[model samples]
Target: MKNEVITIDLGSNSFRVLKYDYLNFKIIDEYHQVTGLADGLIDSGIISFEALNRVVEALCIAKDKLNFNPNNAVCVTTAAMRKAKNSNEALEYIVKNSGAKFKIIDAEEEARLTLLAIKYALKREKIDTQNFTLLDIGGGSTELTISFEDKIYTKSFDFGIVTMTQKALKDGKLFEDLRNQEIVIKEFLATLDFSIKDFPFIATAGTPTTIASIKLGYSYFNYDKNVVNGTILDIEDLENSLKLLKEKSLEELVALVGKGRVEYLEIGTYIYKLFFNVLEKSKSIVLDDGLREGVAIDYALSLK
Candidate 1:
């Protein structure tokens, strides 16, 4: 028998599990499910039962796929679980029902892990230390990490696709009015001293990769080949996708893409547009891997 490490990433919009074989240093199995854990948390600060049940079911399914014992697994929840008012309750429920203990990772750790994963996946030994920024946009939060010549500065913002969409709806911001939200986003980025031209950007998470997949003409997302260490996105293609997606209804968007992602697909598209517009950057390197891979790398590093 071989030792394997199970990494479970309980995200705001999805639940993912990855099993890595220690001996081979390779990912053996991966699973994902859309749970939308942050669906209504923007206004209420509490995760709804519907969302909770969905996530729990996803976890149970992931657990069943584990070839190793549950006790050997390490589970962690990110933005969605962290922001929920009843986070402890939700955490307890997962532990009690799923027999999976989860550690709620903080923003700083999230940023650090994201950087680690980028380094590992890209194998960029000599990153342009002078001017480089890494962005990981999740369902409930977005993390920004600015790397200068010698140091890394990081911050986690509450604005994410799901949370942003909920806020926009609550405030009656028209779904089509992406330009109107620029002021709010500009202010948010200003707090971090982020300027679009300050550095080249690297983006992680589903939106960037999905956009990359669309650019490559992938009818269905191919995570392994299309996403991981994927090529940079073309700005014009991204703009075109955003334009096309905006004109779509919920059903239409899902039909074009797939089911379960319609709820946040439009918002995610908007976010991609907003981020690129703010940075004034025409393109970004899309990283298919994010926090879960980061967590695994962090765990591996700790052993050394």
Candidate 2:
């Protein structure tokens, strides 16, 4: 099937791969693994040897799942690779070892693709995206896009769950770190002239989806996109969840959530809380689809 395509989305916290059939416009197989690529990026300003190896190992596993042939795949990396000083080395190592070519996209391109995914999800949920705002939270950066009549406003922030955890919260000052990041979010949000209250908010990417799953009593192993796609993520609900998450020790947190999530779950959830409060939204629709969907769509179209 020439219409079949594979897309790999490399993130600071995880690596995701999906197989899509352009002919049917359906995703056939999906895989994700947390490699903690961002954990070593903050202080190092480069991709550490260990982090690069972890991602390459994950990519190799992904290749096997896709039958060890991903030549037809569209492999792209996001904020971490785009911002890391040693990104080229890390990507090249993957190419050398795994035979998968990775393209690091800029912030604008990242936001644009995420918006496309939001539109796809909205159509499925029978919602209008013409006047809506989309938030795509990643492990290394956050993207916000607002669409209105004949115009669009978009911005990408440097703060992300894994990045924020390594950069801010590791020093035992969780609230202080959150307050600082919130200031950055608020100032960037204030630049927008659009009436934020006019449009409903939709959030894409892992943080919200994971939060939605936890709120609905599920985990990564038992996650259901259909259940989360149109779920409401409220600020108050997350505030309560934060208190619960904070009480757990590191080991307990990982036991509760997965190892990939425990370290930064609190910060990620808090960021969600900050977004709702700063944007003046009590709750937002959660979308499980993300950049991977957008990548699949684009790769599918390019197959023509």
Candidate 3:
């Protein structure tokens, strides 16, 4: 078990802990909790006491489940912590209550770690990794990464499903907001002075994977990551999935994608659709691997 390592990806919406047997190159155990650490963070510049408690409780639960030393685990917090005004105090509280030491990584480092995971995943899937655009949608930010031979470029946007939904609902401009975001991203790309057309598009994270699950006719209760990985999602299929998601009520949405995710799926799908159109990609491969996997990969690399 000395070769086993733990990676905690404390995201804006979800908190995940993975026990990886790096020697065998496989995940031995994993824990996922929808802590919603970024919930209500848009209006309040600080992490609320309730949100902090939720994260701490989840961390404690994951610690017991995996029985890993908190000091040994590589735990990384993303956008929520980065934007929180009281992040230091929040970290102190989490460590005191749960013994989980977490680090807040910048967007650039976040994208780099995520790229490591995506690259490993693509190689495992027998897909070409020389050229591809990766879309990683989180709760507080979305990262669009373009990877070419020995060079990778990434731009992180502030609006993710959680923050986007909060702002749009507060302003009553969901459609307009989505359109504005799409325009902003396109403009940012234009400034890069390079074309992204013809690059293989790959998306990792909850939204695309959830849509793939629905397309495969698997409910939240029966979701299978193995089948979900490497799934190809065409633009037409995404549109259809959006329509289908919109038709479902909150209860039905929960039945399909789980509780913590129901409210944001529709908006997430809208963002996914916008990115596909912006990238001029008709189809994209969806992968379930993400930050947690990337952290594990980096830790394993460090040992070597």
TM-score of each: 0.86, 0.92, 0.96
Task: Supply the global lDDT for candidate 2.
Answer: 0.81
Candidate 3 local accuracy as lDDT?
0.89
User: Candidate 2 on 1-304: residue-level lDDT in tens?
Assistant: 5667788888889788988887777888888889888777878888888888888888878878776476657888998988898888888887887788999999898887777777777898898657887888789998888878847789898888888888664477667877777788778778887677968988887778877887888866678889988999788778766886867677765655677887777778877877787788877999988888889887666667
Give the number of colliding residue pairs in candidate 3: 0
Q: Candidate 1's residue-wise lDDT over 68-98, tens digit each?
A: 5555678888888888889999888777776
Task: Give the winner by lDDT.
Answer: 3
Total clashing pairs for each candidate: 1, 0, 0
Better of 2 and 3 by TM-score: 3
Q: In lDDT terms, how accurate is model 1?
A: 0.74
**lDDT by candidate, in order shown:** 0.74, 0.81, 0.89
Question: Candidate 3 on 18-129: residue-level lDDT in tens?
Answer: 9998887788999898899988998998888999999988888888888988877889999999999999999999898877889999999999999999899988989965
Q: Report the lDDT of model 2 for residue 1.
A: 59
- Clashes in model 2: which pairs? none
Off by over 4 Å in 3: none
Superposed Cα deviation of residue 115, candidate 3 (Å): 0.4
Model 1: residue 110 alpha-carbon error in angstroms? 0.9
